[model samples]
Target chain A: MPYSSTIAGTRYTFPDLRTLLACASPPRAGDRLAGLAAETAEERVAARMALADLPLKIFLEEPLIPYEQDEVTRLIMDTHDAAAFAPVASMSVGAFRDYLLSDAATTESLRDLAPGLTPEMAAAVSKLMRNQDLIAVAKKISVVTRFRTTIGLPGRLSVRLQPNHPTDDLGGIGASILDGLLYGCGDACIGINPATDSAARVMALLQSIEDLRLRFSIPIQSCVLSHVTTTLDVIAKGAPVDLVFQSIAGSEAANRAFGVDLALLDEAHAAVQNLGRGPDGANLMYFETGQGAALSAEAHHGVDQQTMEARAYAVARRYHPLLVNTVVGFIGPEYLYDGKEIIRAGLEDHFCGKLLGLPMGVDVCYTNHAEADQDDMDNLLTLLGVAGCTYIMGVPGADDIMLGYQSTSYHDALYIRSVLGLKPAPEFEDWLTAMGIMDAAARIRPVTGETQKLLAALP
Target chain B: MTSAPPDDDPFAFLRAKTKARVALGRCGDGLPTTRLLEFQRDHARARDAVHAALDVPVLSAELVATGLPVPIIVQSLAPDRATFLQRPDLGRRLEESSSAKLEKGDYDVSLVLADGLSATAAQKQGAALCALIGKSLSFRCAPPVIACGARVALGDEIAARLGAHLVIVLIGERPGLSSTQSLGAYITFAPKPGVTWDAERNCVSNIGPEGLPLAEAARRIVAMTALAFGIGATGTMLKEDDALAMLEGPGNSSPIDGHRDLQG
Candidate 1:
C-alpha cells in the first residue's frame, strides 16, 4: 500500500512533505498555523512536525496567528444543513473530496457547498479536488442562474453590447450599438469605453445611449465606462446612468491602476440605489477583471494567478455587481503563456467566482499578440455556454478595433444558444420580438425595413 | 542535510529611510520570502488607503484650525469611489449642486484640496501644505476648497469659477505598493474647463513621509507658484529654479522631481 486511494475510478496519491511545501504558499501556511492554534500541545507538535521539513524562509514569511475554526466549520455546517450529505469535518481533505466525487448523487450535492466557501476555505477544500471535480462544480453552479440584478433569468444567457470606439466617435459607436441591437445583444448593458479620457466626451456618449434607450423604448441598461468618477458625474448631472463600470484586479495596486476600491464601489452602489434604476431594483454596478492585472501591477503577492483571480471575486462581491466577467485571454501570452493556460484560467475564474456567489462570465477573447485565435475562443465559448456563463461580450465581427482583439461574436452567440437551447434575457427577448429581429420561433430574421431605417439614421 | 543560511534582506538599509521596494532580490524564480510577505503587506496597505474615506467635516474643521483660510466644501461630479474611478472627466468637473454653491471671487490664487486616488493622503497632507504656502504668499488667496471625489483638473473648474489667476490643486496620487498615502500638487494658470492639456500644468509629486518631506514639498510648491504667477505662465515653460535645500532634512534624500515629465 503506497499511500494511494481510489474512488470514482480515479486515484489520488498522498503527498510527502516536499510536495506539500511546494503547494503550500505563505497564505496557506498562515491558514494552517491558525487552524492548529487552538489545538493541544501534543496535536500542535504533530502538525508542526508535518510542516517542519519546509524551508525555514516559508515560516519566516508567515507568522503564526490564532484563528477561529468554528467560523469556517459553522459555514460548512450551514451548507451541509441544506444538502443531503455526510459529515465531512472528520474526514481528511482528500477523503472529503473523494466522498463527494464517488457518484453522481454526491457530485450533484456540490452546489450546496458554494455559498459557504470563503477564499481560504475554498482554497483548502479545492486542493483536494481534481480538475474534473472543479469542472463538475462549475457545471452545477451555472445551471438555472441569474445575476443579483436579474439580467440572466432562467433559460436565458445575457449579452453586453461592447460598442467600443477608438475615439469618442458617436457615429461609429452608434452604428455598432445598432448592429448589436439588430443581432439581439445588450441584454446585459450597452457598455462603451471611449478612447479619450475627457469628461464631456463620456457624458456625450452616455447621453447618446440614453436617447437611444428612450427613443427605442429599450428596457435594457447602458454604461459609458470612462471612469467611475465620470459615471458619478453623469449620475449627478441627472443624466441617464444605468450601470457604473470599472476594471478590477485581485490586489490593491492593480485596482489602484483601475482607480477603484471597495469604498468607491459602495459609493457608486449607493448613488445608483438612490437613482433606483433597472428592473426589480437591481444592482447598478458592472465590473470587469483579468488574470494578469495583479501581476502586471506588481501586487500579486507571489500567489498563483488563479488564486489571485479568485480573491478578486471577494472584492466584486462587496459591490454586488450586476455583471462580473473575466477578460480571460485578453492579457496576452506573458501571463497565461498559451491557449491551454487560457482555457484553464477561464474555467478556474468561472468556478471560483460562482463558488464565491457571483454572476460569473467570460470574454472568450484573445488579442493579436496572444497565442490564441478564434478556435481557442470557440472551444472556450462552447465550454462556458455548457458551464452556464451569465453573459459574454457581443462585439461586431469578433474583432474589437479599439481593444485590438478577436472575441466571441453575435453569430457565436447564436451558435451557442442553438446548441445549448438558451435565449436572451426575457425583457430583451420581448424587445427583439417587438422589433421583428427575432420571430415567434426565436430565429434570427432579416432586418426589418423600419429597424434598418432607424439604424441608417443613427449615424 | 545541511541547509544554507537565510539570505540577508538586501533592502534593509534603504527600508529604514524609504518605503520604495529597493534591494529586494529574487529567490529561485520568484521574490524572496521576506520580500514576498512585505509585498503582500504593502499591497493590503495600498488597497486600504484607496478605500479609506475622508471625513469631510473633520477635514474642514482641521483646515480652519490651521488658521490659513476657512475651507469651502465642494464636490466633484463623481459621487463615489467607483464612479470616480470610471469617470476621470467627471472628477475634473463640479457637481451641479456644488457649482451653484461655489460663489465667484477674485483672488491671486485658488487653493484646492481634492481627494484623488487616496483620501487619506488629501486629509493628512492638505492642511499642512496649505499652511506652509500661506507663509510665503502675500497676495489674497481664495478660501481653500475641499472637494471630495475630485481629481487634479477639478481645480481648473473651481479656479475658473472663483476667477482666480492661478489654481494649485493638492490631490492624492495613485497609491503605490510601498507608499499608499502620498500627496501631489498640480498648478495651472488661467485654469478653465476645455483646451487644457497636461503640458500646460506643473506638478510636484510624492509628498509624504516616504518620499519628499512635507516642508520641502511646501517650499518648492510656494516657489513654483510665485514663479508661475510672476512669469504669467505655468506648465512646460515653468521651471523650479529656487533651491530649498535646507528644507530637505537629514535622511530625506529621495529624488523630488518625479513629476517634471508628467506634463505632455
Candidate 2:
C-alpha cells in the first residue's frame, strides 16, 4: 500500500518549518523538499542525523518548569478519603478476600497487626487501613530541586509568579518538560493538549524563547506540531502533516479522577472514527489505554491478556507499524502485592515482547518499583523504551534525563508528571553544577535565573 | 574520598544526596557505584539488600534468576546519539564488542542482561544485585554479563553461538526508575544465535523480590515458555494468551496511600 494523501492531509513527516529556519547547516529548500519526497529508511535516518547537527539548545522545550518554591513542598497531603481507590477499605467480602490473596497483603500486610487478638484491636487495624493515608513527610525535599535551581533545563521554569494575565502563553509545565527533551533529543517535536502542544501556543512559546537561545547562540527548539486535546476535535480540525502520533490519555488525571481502564482503546478509536477520520492523513498515538475505560480490569473487560494482545497487535497491524503506540500510564500503588493486577492489565503487551522476542513497553507507575528515586525512575523509563514502548510519559525531575541528556526514540516517554507533581528537589543544584548545566540554566531561567543560582549554590 | 565522621544517620546525607542514583546509572550514564545506597529502601522493592550487596555484581542477575534467568539488551541502532532516538537500531548494539572477552562459557543456562537504552534498568536494584538472583536460585549457573552498553537480542546473539539449553540476559534496564528499571529476559529452550526478537522470547519482571521477586519472575517466565511450547510457537506464532492481563486492570490497581479497597 502506498502512503498517498491529498494536499489537505499529507503524511506526517520530517523537519518543521522552524527546523528549516533554524538549521545551522541549512540545505537548499529545493534539496530538502526533494529529499523529503524521496525519503527512504536511510534518508530518514540521515535527516534525523542532520537534525542532531542542530544545536542541542534549539531542541529545548519552550518555557521551563519552575519546581522550586520556598513554600513549595514536593509532598502533597493525599488524604486517603479523597483518593478514588479509597473505597478499597469499605471493601466487600469479595474485596477483603481478594486483598488477602493479593501480593501486597500476603507479602506485606497493609495493617499494623498486633499480638492482641482482641476484636477491638483487630477491628481497629481494619479501620485504620480503611482510613489510611500515607504521607512522605520530610523537613526538606530539596536535593533534586537545588540541582534544577542551580542548573535550569532548556525549558522555561515558571516561578510561582502569577502571570499578569490569567493565562500565560508558554503552556507552562508541559512546555518545560517538552523543551528540556527538545534541547536534549534535538528532534522534531509535537505536543498534545492545548496547554501542552497547540500550534499557536507552540509557536508563541518558541518565539518567546528566541531571545534566550540567542543569548546562548543557540536556536530555540520549535515544535513541528503542537496539538491540543486528546479528543478527536483537534485531529478533525486538521492534523499536522509532520506530526507522527499524539501522546494522549495520561494516567494521573484519569487515575486521580477515576481509576483505570485498559480495554477502552477500541471504543475510543471508534469514537474518533465516528468523527469521520481514518488515520489516512496522519497516525494517532495513545499513551495509555485508560482515557476511554478509566478503572476496568482487562479480564473484567471480557477478555484475557492474550485477547487484548491480539487486539493490540491487530490495531498496530491496522495503524502505522513504526508508530504502533498503546499508551500506558502508571500510579505506583498497583504493584503492591495484589495491587499488581492493575499494573498487569494496564501493560500493553510489548509488540517487542512478542515481535522482537523481548518484553518491552509495559508502563508501570512509581519511580522506584521498590522506591521513589528520580534517577532510578529515569533508568527504568529508558530501559522500558528499549524494551519497546515507542514512548513512555515521565516526570521532569528524572535524573538520567539531565545527566546523560538522553531522549531516544525506542526509549521515549512523556514527562507530564513534572507539571502535576512538581516538588522541590534539593539535589538538583549539585547535579546542575556537576553536569555543567548551570550556565545553561541562567539562559532561560524564567524568573531570577542568576539570583536563584547564586542562592542555591551558596554553602 | 573523605571518611564520613560517625553520625546518627550514617548514610543519611549520602542517601539524600543520591536521590535517584539508580536511574542515573541505568540510563547510559557510567556504571553507577558512587552515591548509591547499597540496600533497597522499601522492603518491598527489594527482598534483601545486604545479601544483594555481598554478592558479586557480575553474577547477580543469575542469582536473581535462580528459578531461571533470561537476559536481554535492546537499543536503537542509529549510529550517532542524536539519530538513535529516531533510529532504534543504534541503541541495540554496543559500539564495540565490549563483551567479546566476557568469559565465554557453556552451562545449563547462559545469561547476560544489558541496560540497552535505559541505564537506570541495571541499577534499579542498585549494584548488579547478584545476591537477589543467587539467594533465590539454588542451581548450577552459567556466568553472567553485566555491561553498560547492552541489547535485548545480545543474550541470544551470544547464546546462539554458545550452544546452551537456555541463554538469558538481564541487562541494565533503560532508566524509568521513578516508574521502574524493569528487567527483560530472552529465553531459548535450546540456545543459539540468530534468534530474533520474534522467536522463543520469554520474560518475567517487575520482580521487586517483595513486589515481584526474581524467583517468581523465573516462575512466570518458565510458565510463559511452557505455555509457548504447548501452543507450539515459533516466535511470531507464539500466542501469549493472558501473559500481562493484570497490570492495567483497575482491580489490579495498587494505590500509593498504602491503603486500597477491593474492586468487586
Candidate 3:
C-alpha cells in the first residue's frame, strides 16, 4: 500500500505506527492492522498530513514480548537454551542499554536475538560466545538462579586484606591480617604477595592463611598472589586454593611475559570452579593489572594505554575473578607520572572494567619517588567509591613492605564506607556483627571478649 | 664564546640538556600518553636491572677480554636474592669458602666488581672501566674479583686480603627509570673490613652512556684513586671539585652539576 507517513523508511498509513516502530521494533498486523495500512495513494498522502496534526505519542503499547517473570525465563531458555544469560553479559554498557531501551526492547526478546544467542542443534543451534561474554552472562543469568553469592552486587562493597611481608614471616604477616580483619576488612579476600618468588614459599604462606581461616572460622576466601601456574601447582599438591592469582596485561605478549595465557587461565578457572569456597560458591581467580603493561611487554601494537587496560579485562572476565584490581600507582611514575595521571588512569580503569561486568578495585597507591601522596589517593578512593568500586587493598598504615610502596590503609576503607554509606558484603558484615568487632554502622568498636580471644589464639 | 643559549622551547631545551624527568609536555590532564608509556617502560627496565642475576662466568670472560686476567669469582655471605634483600649486613662480608679462597698478595690497588642492586649496571660498565683505569695509570693492580650478591663493604675484605694499599669497588647503583645500567665506583684507601665508614669513602656515581660517559668515568676513577694515594685519606677528606675543575676547566658543567653545586 502506498503510504506517506513513515518510520525507518517503511511507510505506514496510520500515525500510530510511527510510535509502534520506534518503541517495539516491528509491529505485527495487530488486532487493528487493516486500519493502519492504506491501499490507496490519496489515503496514504492524507495519513501523512493527519500524522503531523496528531499529538506526539509515547510508545507505551504492549512491551516487545508480553510475558510474566517465569515466562520470560522460559522464553529465554527456549531461545538460548541453558545459556540464555549470554545475551547481555559481555555487551558494553551503551550496547546493553540500547538493547533494553530500543524499539525491539524487553528482556526476553533481546535474549532471544542477542549477539551470542544460543540454540540447541541437531535440529537446534549451538551457542559459542567469547569467554568474557560467557562470564558476564553468568552474572546476568545468575539473577534468576543467583548461583554466585560473593561481592560486587548492587549497593555492596568488599575489602581485601593485603598483609604483604618481605620475609613471609607467619607471625608478623598474621598480625597484619588480624588487624585488617578486626577493622572490618576481609570481605573480598586475604591475599598475600610473598617477597620471595619461590613456589614453595607461596604454598606455605597460602597454607598458613588457610590454617588461620580454619581456626578463626573466618568465612572469607584466601589467595597467594603468585603466578597462576604456581597456584595451580600448589593446588595440585593438595593445598586449599580458593582462588588462583595472576598479574594480567592487555596483550598476548604481555600475558606471556607475565607467564599466563588463555589456556592457563581456563585451567586455573576450572581448577577452582568446584572448590565451593566463599559464601556464594567459589570465584576461581583474582587478577591484578596496571596500564602500560602491554607497552612494557612491547605488545601494545600502538593501542592507547587505557584501551589496552580494557582488553586486559576481556582476559580477566573469563575466570570470574572474586577480585580484579588495577594496581593504579604501583608500576611507578614512568607510566602514570603524577597524581593527576594516576588518578585519571585509576578512574578510567574502574569505569571500563565495571562496564565490562568485572568486580573492580583500585590499589589507591603510590611510590616514594612519584610526585604523588596520600591526598591524591584520598581523592581517587572517594571518586572510586562514588563510581561503585567493588573493593580496595587494606595494608597496615597503607604501607606494603614487599612492594616498597604505600596503598589504601584500613582507615581509608572505613572512611570511604562511612562517607558513602556503603556496607561490606552481607556475609562479611554478618560475621563482623557476630564477632562484635564492628557496630551495625560498620564502625570499629572495642574488641569484645570473644574477638579478643580469637585474636589471642593466633600463634 | 658562551655555548649556544638554551633552546627557546622549554621541552626541547630540557630534553636536550638533561636526562632528568622534566619539561615532559602535558596533554589534556597529565603527561602526554607517549611520555607516560615511556616512563612505564623505563620503570620496568629499572626493575629488571635490579633483579637481574649476575652472570659471573660471562663477566669474568668479559674482564679477561679487556686484557685484565680472569676475575676470581666469589659470593657474599647472603645465599640468594631473597636473603640479600633482607639481610644487608650479610652481603657486606665474604662467605667462608670465598674467604678460604682468598690469600694475601702485595698490590697497590685492588679492583672488586660487585653486583649491588643492579647486575645490569655492573656487567655493562665494570670490565671496560677496569681496562680504562688500568691502562691510564701504572699501579700494582691485583687480579680483579667478581662478587655476587655483594655490597660496597665487601670491597674492603677483598682489598685487605690482597694486601693492597687502595680498594676500588666498581658496583651497581640502585637503578632509576631513566638510567637502569648506570654504575657506581667507591674508592677507599687503607682498606680493611669494619675499619672504613661511609665518611671514609669516595664515590663516583652515575657512570654510564647517559650519565658520565664511560671514558670520563674511567678518568675520574683513576684521578680519585691517585688523589687518595697522594693524600693520606679519602671520603669527605677527598672531593671531586678539584678533579672536575681540572678536567673540564672553568664554566664547563656536567649533567649532574646542579646537584654538585647544591651539595657545595
DockQ scores of all models, one per candidate: 0.01, 0.02, 0.02
Of 1 and 2, which scores higher on TM-score?
1
lDDT of 2: 0.31
lDDT of 1 by residue, A306-401 (tens): 555665776776666788899987765445545666776787678677766678878888643244556677788888877778899887656565
What are the models' TM-scores?
0.54, 0.30, 0.51
Tens-place lDDT per residue, model 3, A1-459, is: 121445446555433433222121111111011122244544444443433332211111221122242222233234333354444445432354334345554334543433133111100000112223322332231111011236776566678888876567776677777767877888888888876666788878888888887776777878888777777787778777777789987666678878777788888888777566544655667899987676656565443355456657767766667778999887654456668778767765765565445677889987643556677888888877776677898876565655656688776777788888888888778888888977876776754677766666544
lDDT tens per residue, model 1, B166-260: 98888877665456667888889888785677668878888898678788887777777777877788887876653233324332333334322
Sort every candidate by lDDT, greatest first: 1, 3, 2
User: For model 3, how does the per-residue alpha-carbon lDDT over B1-264 read when each residue is reduced to its tens digit?
Assistant: 223323453223323322233333333213356655665566567667767888878888989888987688889998976556434567889998998777788899989888887799888888888888878867899888998988888989888888889988888876654566777788899977977776588777778885788888787877778777878788778776665555465422332221110000
Regions of candidate 1 where Cα sits further than 4 Å from its true position: A1-92, A95-112, A123-132, A142-149, B1-264
lDDT of 3 at A388: 68
Q: What is candidate 2's lDDT per residue for B1-264, written digit by digit as tens?
A: 333333542112322322322122122222223323332233223222101211235435544455434333222233432233222233344434443444455555555555544344455652334444444333356655554333465555555444445655554332332333445555555544443543355544344422445555554444444544455442445433343232222222211111111100
- Candidate 1 TM-score over all chains jointly: 0.54
Stretch of 10 with least lDDT, candidate 1 chain B: B11-20
State interface RMSD in Å for all models.
21.9, 16.4, 20.8
Model 1 DockQ vs. reference = 0.01
Error of 2 at A161 (Å): 21
